[model samples]
Target: MTNDLRARRLALLKEHFASEVAQEFDRTIATFADSPRYEIMPTGQVHDGEDQVIAYHRAQRTAFPDQRHENVRFHVADDDSIIAEFDLLGTNKGEFAGGAPTGKAFRVPTIAVFFFDGERLVNERVYLDSASMLRQIGRMDLLG
Candidate 1:
Protein backbone atom coordinates (compact mmCIF):
# COMPACT_ATOMS: atom_id res chain seq x y z
CA MET A 1 0.00 0.00 0.00
CA THR A 2 1.07 3.55 -0.51
CA ASN A 3 2.39 5.44 2.51
CA ASP A 4 -0.65 7.71 2.43
CA LEU A 5 -3.02 4.77 2.70
CA ARG A 6 -0.99 3.24 5.50
CA ALA A 7 -1.06 6.49 7.43
CA ARG A 8 -4.79 6.86 6.93
CA ARG A 9 -5.40 3.32 8.22
CA LEU A 10 -3.30 3.98 11.31
CA ALA A 11 -5.10 7.24 11.94
CA LEU A 12 -8.49 5.61 11.73
CA LEU A 13 -7.38 2.78 14.02
CA LYS A 14 -6.17 5.26 16.59
CA GLU A 15 -9.43 7.15 16.35
CA HIS A 16 -11.34 3.91 16.82
CA PHE A 17 -9.47 3.04 20.00
CA ALA A 18 -9.77 6.53 21.40
CA SER A 19 -13.50 6.75 20.72
CA GLU A 20 -14.10 3.39 22.38
CA VAL A 21 -12.19 4.47 25.45
CA ALA A 22 -14.11 7.70 25.51
CA GLN A 23 -17.40 5.80 25.31
CA GLU A 24 -18.27 7.63 22.11
CA PHE A 25 -20.03 4.80 20.33
CA ASP A 26 -21.04 6.87 17.33
CA ARG A 27 -17.52 7.94 16.63
CA THR A 28 -16.27 4.41 17.06
CA ILE A 29 -18.82 2.99 14.69
CA ALA A 30 -17.99 5.60 12.10
CA THR A 31 -14.66 3.90 11.56
CA PHE A 32 -16.20 0.90 9.91
CA ALA A 33 -16.15 0.50 6.16
CA ASP A 34 -19.68 -0.83 6.09
CA SER A 35 -21.43 -2.85 8.76
CA PRO A 36 -19.61 -3.21 12.04
CA ARG A 37 -18.31 -6.67 12.94
CA TYR A 38 -16.24 -8.00 15.78
CA GLU A 39 -15.17 -11.52 16.66
CA ILE A 40 -14.06 -12.37 20.15
CA MET A 41 -11.95 -15.37 19.28
CA PRO A 42 -11.53 -16.80 22.77
CA THR A 43 -15.27 -16.86 23.43
CA GLY A 44 -16.36 -17.63 19.89
CA GLN A 45 -18.63 -14.65 20.08
CA VAL A 46 -19.41 -12.73 16.97
CA HIS A 47 -20.97 -9.29 17.19
CA ASP A 48 -22.12 -8.79 13.65
CA GLY A 49 -23.89 -5.82 12.10
CA GLU A 50 -24.52 -2.43 13.65
CA ASP A 51 -26.95 -3.31 16.41
CA GLN A 52 -25.13 -6.37 17.68
CA VAL A 53 -21.81 -4.59 17.67
CA ILE A 54 -23.24 -1.63 19.57
CA ALA A 55 -24.90 -3.91 22.10
CA TYR A 56 -21.70 -5.78 22.66
CA HIS A 57 -19.87 -2.56 23.37
CA ARG A 58 -22.51 -1.45 25.79
CA ALA A 59 -22.45 -4.72 27.69
CA GLN A 60 -18.69 -4.67 28.01
CA ARG A 61 -18.59 -1.06 29.19
CA THR A 62 -21.30 -1.77 31.73
CA ALA A 63 -19.35 -4.70 33.12
CA PHE A 64 -16.09 -2.81 33.18
CA PRO A 65 -16.80 0.86 33.35
CA ASP A 66 -13.17 1.74 33.56
CA GLN A 67 -12.05 -0.45 30.70
CA ARG A 68 -9.10 0.90 28.73
CA HIS A 69 -6.14 -0.21 26.70
CA GLU A 70 -2.49 0.32 27.57
CA ASN A 71 0.95 -0.06 26.08
CA VAL A 72 -0.48 -0.15 22.61
CA ARG A 73 1.70 -1.33 19.74
CA PHE A 74 0.73 -1.63 16.12
CA HIS A 75 2.11 -3.76 13.34
CA VAL A 76 1.19 -3.31 9.71
CA ALA A 77 0.53 -6.94 8.84
CA ASP A 78 -0.27 -6.24 5.20
CA ASP A 79 -1.89 -3.69 2.95
CA ASP A 80 -5.30 -4.63 4.29
CA SER A 81 -4.57 -5.75 7.84
CA ILE A 82 -3.08 -4.37 11.01
CA ILE A 83 -2.23 -6.17 14.23
CA ALA A 84 -2.69 -4.27 17.46
CA GLU A 85 -1.09 -5.43 20.69
CA PHE A 86 -2.07 -4.01 24.04
CA ASP A 87 -3.08 -4.72 27.59
CA LEU A 88 -6.79 -4.78 28.19
CA LEU A 89 -7.29 -3.47 31.69
CA GLY A 90 -10.53 -3.13 33.58
CA THR A 91 -12.22 -3.20 36.96
CA ASN A 92 -15.30 -5.31 37.56
CA LYS A 93 -17.79 -2.81 38.87
CA GLY A 94 -20.91 -4.41 37.44
CA GLU A 95 -22.29 -7.85 36.65
CA PHE A 96 -20.24 -9.85 34.17
CA ALA A 97 -20.60 -13.27 32.65
CA GLY A 98 -23.60 -14.13 34.84
CA GLY A 99 -21.72 -13.28 38.03
CA ALA A 100 -21.94 -10.51 40.56
CA PRO A 101 -19.40 -7.77 40.62
CA THR A 102 -16.09 -8.80 42.17
CA GLY A 103 -14.81 -5.23 42.67
CA LYS A 104 -11.56 -6.64 41.32
CA ALA A 105 -9.31 -5.50 38.54
CA PHE A 106 -7.54 -7.38 35.79
CA ARG A 107 -4.98 -6.63 33.13
CA VAL A 108 -4.80 -9.11 30.33
CA PRO A 109 -2.65 -9.07 27.24
CA THR A 110 -4.72 -8.75 24.10
CA ILE A 111 -4.21 -8.79 20.37
CA ALA A 112 -6.70 -7.50 17.80
CA VAL A 113 -6.31 -8.16 14.14
CA PHE A 114 -7.98 -5.33 12.26
CA PHE A 115 -9.14 -6.11 8.77
CA PHE A 116 -9.57 -3.26 6.38
CA ASP A 117 -11.38 -2.80 3.13
CA GLY A 118 -9.16 -0.07 1.77
CA GLU A 119 -8.95 2.62 4.50
CA ARG A 120 -11.98 1.69 6.54
CA LEU A 121 -12.13 -1.11 9.10
CA VAL A 122 -14.16 -4.14 8.06
CA ASN A 123 -13.71 -6.40 11.09
CA GLU A 124 -11.77 -6.77 14.27
CA ARG A 125 -10.84 -10.24 15.51
CA VAL A 126 -9.65 -10.19 19.08
CA TYR A 127 -7.63 -12.75 21.00
CA LEU A 128 -7.16 -12.14 24.66
CA ASP A 129 -5.92 -13.97 27.75
CA SER A 130 -9.32 -14.74 29.19
CA ALA A 131 -7.96 -17.24 31.69
CA SER A 132 -5.73 -14.68 33.31
CA MET A 133 -8.46 -12.06 33.28
CA LEU A 134 -10.98 -14.42 34.86
CA ARG A 135 -8.52 -15.53 37.53
CA GLN A 136 -7.64 -11.99 38.41
CA ILE A 137 -11.30 -11.00 38.63
CA GLY A 138 -12.09 -13.95 40.95
CA ARG A 139 -13.88 -15.99 38.33
CA MET A 140 -11.76 -19.08 38.18
CA ASP A 141 -14.91 -21.17 38.04
CA LEU A 142 -15.60 -19.84 34.60
CA LEU A 143 -12.40 -21.43 33.38
CA GLY A 144 -14.26 -24.72 33.15
Candidate 2:
Protein backbone atom coordinates (compact mmCIF):
# COMPACT_ATOMS: atom_id res chain seq x y z
CA MET A 1 0.00 0.00 0.00
CA THR A 2 1.83 3.11 -1.19
CA ASN A 3 -0.66 5.40 0.50
CA ASP A 4 -0.19 3.67 3.81
CA LEU A 5 3.56 3.96 3.57
CA ARG A 6 3.30 7.63 2.71
CA ALA A 7 0.98 8.23 5.65
CA ARG A 8 3.38 6.52 7.97
CA ARG A 9 6.27 8.57 6.70
CA LEU A 10 4.26 11.75 7.05
CA ALA A 11 3.32 10.82 10.58
CA LEU A 12 6.91 10.14 11.46
CA LEU A 13 8.00 13.53 10.12
CA LYS A 14 5.22 15.41 11.89
CA GLU A 15 5.91 13.74 15.19
CA HIS A 16 9.63 14.25 14.85
CA PHE A 17 9.26 17.97 14.20
CA ALA A 18 6.48 18.67 16.69
CA SER A 19 8.23 16.83 19.46
CA GLU A 20 11.69 18.09 18.51
CA VAL A 21 13.01 14.58 18.32
CA ALA A 22 16.55 15.18 17.20
CA GLN A 23 17.48 11.52 16.76
CA GLU A 24 14.37 10.80 14.83
CA PHE A 25 15.06 13.76 12.59
CA ASP A 26 18.40 12.22 11.85
CA ARG A 27 17.11 8.72 11.34
CA THR A 28 14.20 9.72 9.17
CA ILE A 29 16.05 12.23 7.09
CA ALA A 30 18.96 9.85 6.66
CA THR A 31 16.68 7.75 4.56
CA PHE A 32 17.39 10.24 1.82
CA ALA A 33 20.56 8.22 1.23
CA ASP A 34 22.40 11.22 -0.17
CA SER A 35 22.82 14.91 0.37
CA PRO A 36 19.36 16.40 0.76
CA ARG A 37 18.27 19.81 -0.43
CA TYR A 38 15.56 22.25 0.53
CA GLU A 39 14.35 25.17 -1.52
CA ILE A 40 12.66 27.97 0.38
CA MET A 41 10.59 29.73 -2.23
CA PRO A 42 9.91 32.95 -0.38
CA THR A 43 13.55 33.88 -0.01
CA GLY A 44 14.97 31.75 -2.79
CA GLN A 45 17.41 30.24 -0.33
CA VAL A 46 18.53 26.69 -0.74
CA HIS A 47 19.74 24.60 2.18
CA ASP A 48 21.48 21.28 1.99
CA GLY A 49 21.60 18.41 4.49
CA GLU A 50 20.62 17.78 8.10
CA ASP A 51 23.02 20.31 9.54
CA GLN A 52 21.53 23.12 7.54
CA VAL A 53 18.04 22.07 8.52
CA ILE A 54 19.01 22.00 12.15
CA ALA A 55 20.64 25.39 11.87
CA TYR A 56 17.58 26.85 10.25
CA HIS A 57 15.39 25.54 13.03
CA ARG A 58 17.76 26.83 15.64
CA ALA A 59 17.64 30.31 14.17
CA GLN A 60 13.88 30.18 14.00
CA ARG A 61 13.58 29.06 17.58
CA THR A 62 15.98 31.73 18.71
CA ALA A 63 13.79 34.38 17.11
CA PHE A 64 10.38 32.88 17.88
CA PRO A 65 10.67 30.38 20.67
CA ASP A 66 6.93 30.14 21.03
CA GLN A 67 6.20 29.49 17.41
CA ARG A 68 3.84 26.61 16.63
CA HIS A 69 2.93 25.07 13.31
CA GLU A 70 -0.50 23.54 12.76
CA ASN A 71 -1.12 21.30 9.82
CA VAL A 72 -4.24 22.22 7.88
CA ARG A 73 -4.10 20.00 4.83
CA PHE A 74 -2.12 17.27 3.09
CA HIS A 75 -1.88 15.88 -0.41
CA VAL A 76 -0.01 12.78 -1.45
CA ALA A 77 1.17 12.33 -5.00
CA ASP A 78 1.41 9.00 -6.78
CA ASP A 79 5.18 9.25 -6.77
CA ASP A 80 5.38 9.53 -2.95
CA SER A 81 5.56 13.30 -2.88
CA ILE A 82 3.69 15.07 -0.12
CA ILE A 83 2.27 18.57 -0.07
CA ALA A 84 1.42 19.94 3.32
CA GLU A 85 -0.34 23.15 4.22
CA PHE A 86 0.09 24.65 7.62
CA ASP A 87 -0.56 27.73 9.71
CA LEU A 88 2.27 29.14 11.77
CA LEU A 89 1.43 31.17 14.86
CA GLY A 90 3.89 32.99 16.98
CA THR A 91 4.88 36.20 18.73
CA ASN A 92 8.04 37.87 17.50
CA LYS A 93 9.90 38.56 20.73
CA GLY A 94 13.44 38.31 19.38
CA GLU A 95 15.18 39.79 16.37
CA PHE A 96 14.29 38.11 13.06
CA ALA A 97 16.42 39.38 10.21
CA GLY A 98 15.55 43.11 10.55
CA GLY A 99 12.16 42.88 12.23
CA ALA A 100 13.52 44.20 15.54
CA PRO A 101 11.39 42.50 18.16
CA THR A 102 7.93 43.54 17.10
CA GLY A 103 6.53 41.52 20.03
CA LYS A 104 3.49 41.22 17.80
CA ALA A 105 1.59 38.01 17.12
CA PHE A 106 1.21 36.67 13.60
CA ARG A 107 -0.55 33.81 11.87
CA VAL A 108 0.99 32.90 8.55
CA PRO A 109 -0.03 30.21 6.10
CA THR A 110 2.61 28.11 4.36
CA ILE A 111 2.79 25.20 1.98
CA ALA A 112 5.63 22.73 1.56
CA VAL A 113 6.19 19.83 -0.78
CA PHE A 114 8.32 16.90 0.21
CA PHE A 115 9.79 14.40 -2.19
CA PHE A 116 10.59 11.01 -0.81
CA ASP A 117 12.97 8.25 -1.81
CA GLY A 118 11.29 5.19 -0.41
CA GLU A 119 10.52 6.24 3.18
CA ARG A 120 13.01 9.04 3.54
CA LEU A 121 12.49 12.64 2.52
CA VAL A 122 14.98 13.56 -0.17
CA ASN A 123 13.96 17.08 -1.09
CA GLU A 124 11.60 19.84 -0.05
CA ARG A 125 10.25 23.05 -1.49
CA VAL A 126 8.52 25.46 0.82
CA TYR A 127 6.27 28.35 -0.10
CA LEU A 128 5.63 31.15 2.32
CA ASP A 129 3.77 34.42 1.82
CA SER A 130 6.34 36.65 3.47
CA ALA A 131 4.73 39.90 2.34
CA SER A 132 1.63 39.18 4.42
CA MET A 133 3.76 38.01 7.29
CA LEU A 134 5.82 41.23 7.18
CA ARG A 135 2.61 43.24 7.17
CA GLN A 136 1.35 41.35 10.19
CA ILE A 137 4.56 42.13 12.04
CA GLY A 138 4.12 45.85 11.26
CA ARG A 139 7.32 46.04 9.25
CA MET A 140 5.75 46.50 5.83
CA ASP A 141 3.87 49.76 5.30
CA LEU A 142 2.06 48.69 2.14
CA LEU A 143 -0.93 47.09 3.88
CA GLY A 144 -2.33 50.15 5.62
Candidate 3:
Protein backbone atom coordinates (compact mmCIF):
# COMPACT_ATOMS: atom_id res chain seq x y z
CA MET A 1 0.00 0.00 0.00
CA THR A 2 2.91 2.29 0.68
CA ASN A 3 5.22 3.67 -1.99
CA ASP A 4 8.02 1.35 -0.85
CA LEU A 5 5.74 -1.68 -1.08
CA ARG A 6 4.57 -0.76 -4.57
CA ALA A 7 8.15 -0.33 -5.71
CA ARG A 8 9.16 -3.70 -4.32
CA ARG A 9 6.23 -5.44 -5.99
CA LEU A 10 7.03 -3.81 -9.30
CA ALA A 11 10.65 -4.87 -9.03
CA LEU A 12 9.65 -8.44 -8.32
CA LEU A 13 7.30 -8.47 -11.30
CA LYS A 14 10.05 -7.15 -13.55
CA GLU A 15 12.39 -9.87 -12.36
CA HIS A 16 9.75 -12.51 -12.91
CA PHE A 17 9.11 -11.37 -16.50
CA ALA A 18 12.80 -11.06 -17.28
CA SER A 19 13.57 -14.54 -16.03
CA GLU A 20 10.73 -16.00 -18.03
CA VAL A 21 11.87 -14.31 -21.24
CA ALA A 22 15.37 -15.57 -20.54
CA GLN A 23 14.03 -19.09 -20.20
CA GLU A 24 15.45 -19.23 -16.72
CA PHE A 25 12.69 -21.24 -15.15
CA ASP A 26 14.52 -21.76 -11.89
CA ARG A 27 14.90 -18.04 -11.33
CA THR A 28 11.33 -17.43 -12.34
CA ILE A 29 10.05 -20.03 -9.91
CA ALA A 30 12.13 -18.53 -7.15
CA THR A 31 10.10 -15.34 -7.45
CA PHE A 32 7.08 -17.17 -6.14
CA ALA A 33 6.08 -18.07 -2.61
CA ASP A 34 5.78 -21.66 -1.39
CA SER A 35 3.23 -22.43 -4.06
CA PRO A 36 3.01 -21.07 -7.63
CA ARG A 37 0.04 -21.06 -9.94
CA TYR A 38 -0.68 -19.96 -13.52
CA GLU A 39 -3.97 -19.67 -15.29
CA ILE A 40 -4.43 -19.12 -19.02
CA MET A 41 -7.85 -17.54 -19.18
CA PRO A 42 -8.40 -18.06 -22.92
CA THR A 43 -7.58 -21.73 -22.73
CA GLY A 44 -9.14 -22.32 -19.36
CA GLN A 45 -5.97 -24.14 -18.32
CA VAL A 46 -4.47 -23.99 -14.88
CA HIS A 47 -1.02 -25.02 -13.80
CA ASP A 48 -0.42 -25.22 -10.07
CA GLY A 49 2.54 -26.04 -7.85
CA GLU A 50 6.18 -25.99 -8.85
CA ASP A 51 6.20 -29.08 -11.03
CA GLN A 52 3.10 -28.23 -13.01
CA VAL A 53 4.17 -24.65 -13.42
CA ILE A 54 7.57 -25.71 -14.68
CA ALA A 55 6.02 -28.12 -17.13
CA TYR A 56 3.68 -25.45 -18.43
CA HIS A 57 6.56 -23.08 -19.03
CA ARG A 58 8.48 -25.81 -20.81
CA ALA A 59 5.65 -26.57 -23.16
CA GLN A 60 5.18 -22.92 -24.11
CA ARG A 61 8.88 -22.29 -24.58
CA THR A 62 9.20 -25.42 -26.61
CA ALA A 63 6.62 -24.09 -29.01
CA PHE A 64 7.99 -20.57 -29.04
CA PRO A 65 11.66 -20.74 -28.33
CA ASP A 66 12.07 -17.07 -29.11
CA GLN A 67 9.07 -15.92 -27.10
CA ARG A 68 9.55 -12.45 -25.65
CA HIS A 69 7.56 -9.47 -24.47
CA GLU A 70 7.60 -5.94 -25.78
CA ASN A 71 6.12 -2.59 -24.81
CA VAL A 72 5.46 -3.76 -21.28
CA ARG A 73 3.23 -1.64 -19.04
CA PHE A 74 2.40 -2.28 -15.41
CA HIS A 75 -0.56 -1.21 -13.29
CA VAL A 76 -0.86 -1.44 -9.54
CA ALA A 77 -4.38 -2.78 -9.19
CA ASP A 78 -4.41 -3.11 -5.42
CA ASP A 79 -2.32 -4.11 -2.47
CA ASP A 80 -2.32 -7.76 -3.51
CA SER A 81 -2.40 -7.62 -7.30
CA ILE A 82 -0.69 -6.00 -10.25
CA ILE A 83 -1.76 -6.02 -13.88
CA ALA A 84 0.69 -6.20 -16.80
CA GLU A 85 0.06 -5.38 -20.43
CA PHE A 86 2.47 -6.26 -23.20
CA ASP A 87 2.94 -7.56 -26.67
CA LEU A 88 3.91 -11.21 -26.76
CA LEU A 89 5.90 -12.07 -29.85
CA GLY A 90 7.18 -15.46 -30.90
CA THR A 91 7.83 -17.74 -33.84
CA ASN A 92 6.45 -21.21 -34.08
CA LYS A 93 9.56 -23.29 -34.46
CA GLY A 94 8.50 -26.36 -32.59
CA GLU A 95 5.40 -28.49 -32.13
CA PHE A 96 2.39 -26.83 -30.54
CA ALA A 97 -0.82 -28.44 -29.44
CA GLY A 98 0.22 -31.73 -31.08
CA GLY A 99 0.70 -29.98 -34.40
CA ALA A 100 3.83 -29.25 -36.39
CA PRO A 101 5.29 -25.81 -36.40
CA THR A 102 4.05 -23.37 -39.00
CA GLY A 103 7.34 -21.52 -39.31
CA LYS A 104 5.40 -18.33 -38.69
CA ALA A 105 5.68 -15.48 -36.26
CA PHE A 106 2.93 -13.74 -34.36
CA ARG A 107 2.53 -10.85 -31.99
CA VAL A 108 -0.47 -10.53 -29.75
CA PRO A 109 -1.40 -8.21 -26.95
CA THR A 110 -1.63 -9.93 -23.60
CA ILE A 111 -2.61 -9.04 -20.08
CA ALA A 112 -1.46 -10.86 -16.99
CA VAL A 113 -2.82 -10.16 -13.54
CA PHE A 114 -0.28 -11.06 -10.91
CA PHE A 115 -1.48 -11.90 -7.43
CA PHE A 116 0.97 -11.60 -4.60
CA ASP A 117 1.20 -12.17 -0.89
CA GLY A 118 3.36 -9.41 0.46
CA GLU A 119 6.36 -9.49 -1.90
CA ARG A 120 6.17 -12.99 -3.34
CA LEU A 121 3.95 -13.86 -6.28
CA VAL A 122 1.20 -16.42 -5.79
CA ASN A 123 -0.60 -16.61 -9.15
CA GLU A 124 -0.51 -15.12 -12.64
CA ARG A 125 -3.69 -15.15 -14.65
CA VAL A 126 -3.12 -14.33 -18.32
CA TYR A 127 -5.61 -13.13 -20.89
CA LEU A 128 -4.85 -13.17 -24.58
CA ASP A 129 -6.53 -13.56 -27.93
CA SER A 130 -5.61 -17.09 -28.82
CA ALA A 131 -7.63 -16.91 -32.03
CA SER A 132 -5.62 -13.97 -33.28
CA MET A 133 -2.38 -15.69 -32.41
CA LEU A 134 -3.43 -18.85 -34.20
CA ARG A 135 -4.54 -16.95 -37.26
CA GLN A 136 -1.34 -15.01 -37.47
CA ILE A 137 0.68 -18.20 -37.21
CA GLY A 138 -1.36 -19.87 -39.95
CA ARG A 139 -2.77 -22.34 -37.49
CA MET A 140 -6.39 -21.35 -37.47
CA ASP A 141 -7.23 -24.98 -38.15
CA LEU A 142 -6.53 -25.63 -34.53
CA LEU A 143 -9.69 -23.77 -33.71
CA GLY A 144 -11.84 -26.61 -35.03
Candidate 4:
Protein backbone atom coordinates (compact mmCIF):
# COMPACT_ATOMS: atom_id res chain seq x y z
CA MET A 1 0.00 0.00 0.00
CA THR A 2 2.83 2.34 0.84
CA ASN A 3 4.53 1.48 -2.42
CA ASP A 4 1.34 2.20 -4.28
CA LEU A 5 0.99 5.56 -2.59
CA ARG A 6 4.60 6.43 -3.30
CA ALA A 7 4.23 5.46 -6.91
CA ARG A 8 1.12 7.55 -7.27
CA ARG A 9 2.68 10.57 -5.61
CA LEU A 10 5.81 10.23 -7.68
CA ALA A 11 3.75 9.95 -10.80
CA LEU A 12 1.79 13.02 -9.91
CA LEU A 13 4.95 15.01 -9.27
CA LYS A 14 6.55 13.83 -12.46
CA GLU A 15 3.50 14.55 -14.59
CA HIS A 16 2.94 17.98 -13.11
CA PHE A 17 6.52 19.18 -13.07
CA ALA A 18 7.61 17.50 -16.24
CA SER A 19 4.73 18.51 -18.42
CA GLU A 20 4.00 21.88 -16.90
CA VAL A 21 7.47 23.19 -16.13
CA ALA A 22 9.75 21.18 -18.37
CA GLN A 23 7.54 21.08 -21.40
CA GLU A 24 6.11 24.56 -20.92
CA PHE A 25 2.60 23.23 -21.32
CA ASP A 26 1.05 26.54 -20.28
CA ARG A 27 -1.47 24.74 -18.11
CA THR A 28 0.67 25.03 -15.01
CA ILE A 29 -2.00 26.87 -13.10
CA ALA A 30 -4.44 24.03 -13.44
CA THR A 31 -1.77 21.52 -12.53
CA PHE A 32 -0.87 23.34 -9.32
CA ALA A 33 -4.23 22.37 -7.81
CA ASP A 34 -2.83 18.93 -7.17
CA SER A 35 0.34 20.22 -5.57
CA PRO A 36 1.29 21.33 -2.12
CA ARG A 37 1.93 24.82 -0.88
CA TYR A 38 5.56 25.53 -1.69
CA GLU A 39 7.48 27.84 0.55
CA ILE A 40 10.88 29.02 -0.48
CA MET A 41 12.75 29.25 2.78
CA PRO A 42 15.20 31.90 3.93
CA THR A 43 13.40 34.29 1.62
CA GLY A 44 10.02 33.44 3.09
CA GLN A 45 8.36 33.45 -0.29
CA VAL A 46 5.16 31.50 -0.12
CA HIS A 47 3.20 30.26 -3.10
CA ASP A 48 -0.04 29.21 -1.48
CA GLY A 49 -2.36 28.00 -4.20
CA GLU A 50 -2.34 26.45 -7.62
CA ASP A 51 -2.98 29.77 -9.30
CA GLN A 52 -0.19 31.48 -7.44
CA VAL A 53 2.18 28.65 -8.13
CA ILE A 54 1.36 28.79 -11.80
CA ALA A 55 1.82 32.52 -11.89
CA TYR A 56 5.12 32.16 -10.13
CA HIS A 57 6.25 29.53 -12.59
CA ARG A 58 5.06 31.59 -15.50
CA ALA A 59 7.35 34.40 -14.50
CA GLN A 60 10.13 31.94 -13.83
CA ARG A 61 9.72 30.26 -17.17
CA THR A 62 9.72 33.59 -18.90
CA ALA A 63 12.95 34.47 -17.16
CA PHE A 64 14.65 31.14 -17.63
CA PRO A 65 12.93 29.34 -20.44
CA ASP A 66 15.58 26.72 -20.54
CA GLN A 67 15.42 25.88 -16.88
CA ARG A 68 15.03 22.22 -15.98
CA HIS A 69 14.77 20.29 -12.73
CA GLU A 70 16.00 16.72 -12.55
CA ASN A 71 15.15 14.52 -9.66
CA VAL A 72 18.20 12.59 -8.52
CA ARG A 73 16.90 10.70 -5.53
CA PHE A 74 13.67 10.08 -3.70
CA HIS A 75 12.84 8.43 -0.39
CA VAL A 76 9.42 7.70 1.09
CA ALA A 77 9.14 8.17 4.82
CA ASP A 78 7.16 5.98 7.19
CA ASP A 79 4.72 8.83 7.64
CA ASP A 80 4.07 8.99 3.87
CA SER A 81 6.22 12.07 3.37
CA ILE A 82 8.75 12.18 0.57
CA ILE A 83 12.28 13.52 0.46
CA ALA A 84 13.80 14.33 -2.87
CA GLU A 85 17.12 15.59 -4.15
CA PHE A 86 17.25 17.41 -7.45
CA ASP A 87 19.34 19.58 -9.70
CA LEU A 88 18.09 22.82 -11.17
CA LEU A 89 19.80 24.12 -14.27
CA GLY A 90 19.07 27.24 -16.19
CA THR A 91 20.33 30.33 -17.96
CA ASN A 92 19.48 33.61 -16.32
CA LYS A 93 17.71 35.92 -18.71
CA GLY A 94 15.62 37.97 -16.30
CA GLU A 95 15.55 39.27 -12.77
CA PHE A 96 15.47 36.65 -10.05
CA ALA A 97 14.73 37.30 -6.38
CA GLY A 98 15.77 40.95 -6.89
CA GLY A 99 19.03 39.82 -8.42
CA ALA A 100 19.61 41.48 -11.75
CA PRO A 101 19.88 39.53 -14.93
CA THR A 102 23.09 37.50 -14.94
CA GLY A 103 23.04 36.18 -18.51
CA LYS A 104 24.92 33.18 -17.18
CA ALA A 105 24.18 29.49 -17.00
CA PHE A 106 23.91 27.84 -13.62
CA ARG A 107 23.41 24.42 -12.08
CA VAL A 108 22.33 24.18 -8.46
CA PRO A 109 21.60 21.23 -6.24
CA THR A 110 18.48 21.27 -4.11
CA ILE A 111 16.62 19.03 -1.71
CA ALA A 112 12.95 19.08 -0.76
CA VAL A 113 10.86 17.26 1.82
CA PHE A 114 7.23 16.91 0.86
CA PHE A 115 4.49 16.25 3.37
CA PHE A 116 1.34 14.53 2.22
CA ASP A 117 -2.30 14.57 3.27
CA GLY A 118 -3.86 11.46 1.83
CA GLU A 119 -2.78 11.51 -1.83
CA ARG A 120 -2.33 15.22 -2.14
CA LEU A 121 0.81 17.06 -1.14
CA VAL A 122 0.18 19.31 1.80
CA ASN A 123 3.47 21.16 2.06
CA GLU A 124 6.96 21.18 0.67
CA ARG A 125 9.97 22.41 2.55
CA VAL A 126 12.99 22.90 0.36
CA TYR A 127 16.65 23.25 1.32
CA LEU A 128 19.32 24.56 -0.95
CA ASP A 129 22.40 26.78 -0.95
CA SER A 130 21.12 29.86 -2.71
CA ALA A 131 24.45 31.52 -2.08
CA SER A 132 26.14 28.96 -4.27
CA MET A 133 23.52 29.52 -6.93
CA LEU A 134 24.15 33.24 -6.73
CA ARG A 135 27.87 32.66 -6.95
CA GLN A 136 27.40 30.41 -9.95
CA ILE A 137 25.49 33.19 -11.64
CA GLY A 138 28.25 35.66 -10.75
CA ARG A 139 26.03 37.73 -8.51
CA MET A 140 27.64 37.03 -5.14
CA ASP A 141 31.22 38.11 -4.48
CA LEU A 142 31.66 35.80 -1.51
CA LEU A 143 33.49 33.17 -3.54
CA GLY A 144 35.63 35.59 -5.49
Candidate 1 matches the true fold with a TM-score of: 0.98
Give the winner by TM-score: 3 or 4: 3
What CA RMSD would candidate 2 show? 3.3
Assess each prediction's global lDDT (C-alpha) against the native. 0.95, 0.72, 0.95, 0.71
Which 10-residue span in candidate 2 carries the lowest summed lDDT? 16-25
How far out, in Å, is residue 70 in model 1?
Answer: 0.5
Winner by lDDT? 1
lDDT computed for candidate 4: 0.71
- lDDT tens digits by residue: candidate 1, 1-109: 9899999999999999999999999999999999999999999999999899889999999999999999999999756899999999999999998999999999999
Worst 10 residues of 1 by lDDT: 72-81
Comparing 1 with 4 on lDDT, the higher-scoring candidate is 1
Tens-digit lDDT string for candidate 2 (1-144): 366797787785575455533433455455554776779898888888878866776677666778777765777777768788889777778878855788887889998888877777778788988788887877775334
Residue pairs clashing, model 3: none
lDDT of 3 by residue, 1-144 (tens): 989989999999999999999999999999998788999999999999999999999999999999999999999976699999999999999999999999999999999999999989999999999999999999989898
Pairs of residues clashing in candidate 1: none
Return the lDDT, model 1, position 73.
Answer: 97
Off by over 4 Å in 1: none
Two-way lDDT contest, 1 vs 2, winner? 1
